[model samples]
Target: IHRQAHLVEGFSEPFRRAVEREIRRLGVEIWAGCQVKAFGPEHVWLSDGTELIAQTRLWAGGFQVPSWLSTCGLPTGPTGALLVDKYLRVQGSEHILAVGDCADFVWGSRLLPKIGVYAVRQGPIAAQNLLRLIRGQPLIPYRPQATVFVCVTVGNRVAVAEKGRLVWRGYSATVLKNFFDWLYMRKLKPLRWQEFFY
Candidate 1:
């Protein structure tokens, strides 16, 4: 993985270390803090003047919102995410709402990071607030939790989970991650619960 320092930043220290250990166990070389300067047909040059010979190259740097958001005439942040209020409603427009990675939710003094946890939590609040607006009722304000759960899976055997100061890893963590995935899938298809149970 081409990550700088922490494999999964914002997660607990133990969680990050566990993921690093698992990835190393899988024989995957981690070029931490090393930036790709150039790529040739058979090798890649690093920022530190080192060259790595590889056949396949995968870029897993980060993510950004679509560039078209800026062209939509919406109030966007530096990352081109639409500016949204606490209720996930677009700023200066009651009818226009934003959610998920496309929204730059203003939470207290900082904009919330683009993450699935925040998006999952924002979904219901946005739906309720939209209904309230249509019913002429008061829109409910969103209050994010102080801590969020983060899990990273390495291959199919190893995983790490972190919630605040608590951390779990190894096969048990992988099982937990799978359970969370099942829960998310269940939310999308309630009828699939039977398939999940069996």
Candidate 2:
């Protein structure tokens, strides 16, 4: 369970905080600000010079989208993110488009963060721009109105919420995060028996 703990941790702040809270509730203390320097067959090394000989370790680090846009002959940023214009069209190709994790777009002064929320917003904008191109109409610029909410699991009986500039914490927040997670999954995959499984 610890090995796969990152799956929940990497999802969102609410989830991670909730799980951490539970771990502490179980009497297991965790250290913060400790960075792992290396992993070997029998031990893990930390930046602080601490070593732990554990049979298993889980990386709760996070995720990155596999991007090979340049190999496909498209221009990409240093991070391999496909560079697209306002219409979500690939930088050098009028007919080519990029979306979701592979594409990178700037919203005003901010480089849009990679998250599922932006991908959901990009789908329709990309489709609209594609349609306009086919019909020879003026293309609509994809202006994403971005908002993010994060819930993190804090060790036992507490969670944290970052909804806009607002923040909240405690057990109520944890319950709210869990409920929202259930709602999101159900909305995405309505056929799943979320209430039973989750």
lDDT of 1: 0.78
lDDT accuracy of residue 16 in candidate 1: 77
Candidate with best TM-score:
1
lDDT of 2 by residue, 177-198 (tens): 7776677677667644445332
Q: Please give, for residues 1-198, the per-residue lDDT of candidate 1 as tens digits.
A: 353675565455687787788788899878787678999989989988888898888887577688899999879975689998877788888888889889887766776767788888888999999899999998888888888877777876677778888887777776776777788987676655444332
Give TM-scores for every candidate, taking all chains together and pairing residue i with residue i. Answer: 0.80, 0.66
Runs of candidate 2 exceeding 4 Å displacement: 1-38, 46-50, 153-158, 178-184, 191-198
Best by lDDT: 1
Task: For candidate 1, give the lDDT of residue 14.
Answer: 80
